[model samples]
Target: MQDATPSAIRSAGPASLETRLEEAARYALLRRLTPALRHHMIGALQPLGMLAAMLERRSQAPAPDMASITKKSNEMGVLSREATAACVGLVAWITPKTADAVSIADGVKDCLGVLETDLALRGFIAVNEATEATALVARAIMRNVYAAALLAITDAAPGPAEVIMQSRQEGDTQIVSITLKPREAEPMGIGGPSYRALDWEDVEALAKAEGVVLEHSATGAVLRIAP
Candidate 1:
């Protein structure tokens, strides 16, 4: 998996403060995602470790049962494939795609995959209810805006809630609405390692840098993207 850190900072000589802040926010998002990303990858590979240990014990037994060993081997094979797929999907978030254009549904799904675990820990649930939304837009930009929305909204609410994402096409633009629905519960406490909280200001700066139109509503924020 390639690092998602913005290369523009290294490639471009000097940038305005606005651009710098946007870059900082982008890097902050990646930092915030790192813990959950590592947790997820470790989780996917955990079963394989357990299975290997079990197989080792069985093989060391005085009377080794070939049938049982074969069954365990098959189970390991299935689990290995599943773990590989999960890792691949997670890696794509950081890796650049050959094709920049992506369907709104797919883009939302990918972003949610990265943010969902972290959001849950933060006392929020991210639901990508964006079926039938076929608007094609720049994948990376949309994902950055989505990450910002998920972080900013949760920060503002600071309690148990549901972040719903829905999309629709209006002429040449694709509108992704992230609405917050309240829940009667307290905010979760994720003790220990923590990352910088994403502010609304950060979200605005990121949107501006990516040329995405950002609008805040009573419910949440809306991102307007063009192909």
Candidate 2:
């Protein structure tokens, strides 16, 4: 039988080789960072301080728009002043290190945490009785974040894709599932296996980190999560 692997069929040149390696590296890095950042942000938001700051800011403004909120937060020399302060407090409580690495990571995590919590509290998500609704919203946000990060790192688009979200309730326990399908054919000159290859492990990791079960097959991918 002839080898079906992509490497057996094509020879990659210098530029294409560099691009492929860079894309793979970026995908791997984002996969690693997503869960860690999510956890850190969640931890940063646990303290009442960040919430209090958001509330205070909201109270002061007649109606805070996204731009206005972002502007005000930037003026404070942090993504969200209250969230940043809260993150610093938490970091101090945990790690006393004030190194640049620690500060930058914590700052970014706190900003993301505040943004996520704010969106949830603002009813941007349809929190229906069905758990699937919530999971869908979460999946959408995470995918958006993932796409944006990928673009930032690679200067390449991740393109539009369909994400499947499934929810089930049995007795009192709920289960959720999520899957991502590329909207377009995979690019040529990429992935050692084949241009049609999909990053199944990356998708699975993202879904699992979000507390969803992800399954993929020849037809497409499926995701299930609980409320």
RMSD of each: 6.6, 15.7
Error of 1 at 14 (Å): 8.3
TM-score winner? 1
Runs in model 2 deviating more than 4 A are 1-80, 83-159, 164-166, 171-173, 179-198, 202-214, 218-220, 223-227
Candidate 2 per-residue lDDT, tens place, 111-176, comes to: 344333322222222122222232123423234223223222222224333343334555444343
Pairs with backbone N, CA or C atoms under 3 Å apart (clashes), candidate 2: 175-225, 176-224, 176-225, 176-226, 177-223, 177-224, 177-225, 178-223, 178-224
- Give stretches of model 1 more than 4 Å off: 1-14, 96-99, 189-193
TM-score of 1: 0.82
Candidate 2, poorest ten consecutive residues by summed lDDT = 123-132
lDDT of 1 by residue, 139-221 (tens): 77766777777777777674688889898888888888899998988768676226777778888887887789999854689
RMSD score of candidate 2 (Å): 15.7
List the global CA lDDT of all models: 0.79, 0.40
Query: Best lDDT goes to which candidate?
Result: 1
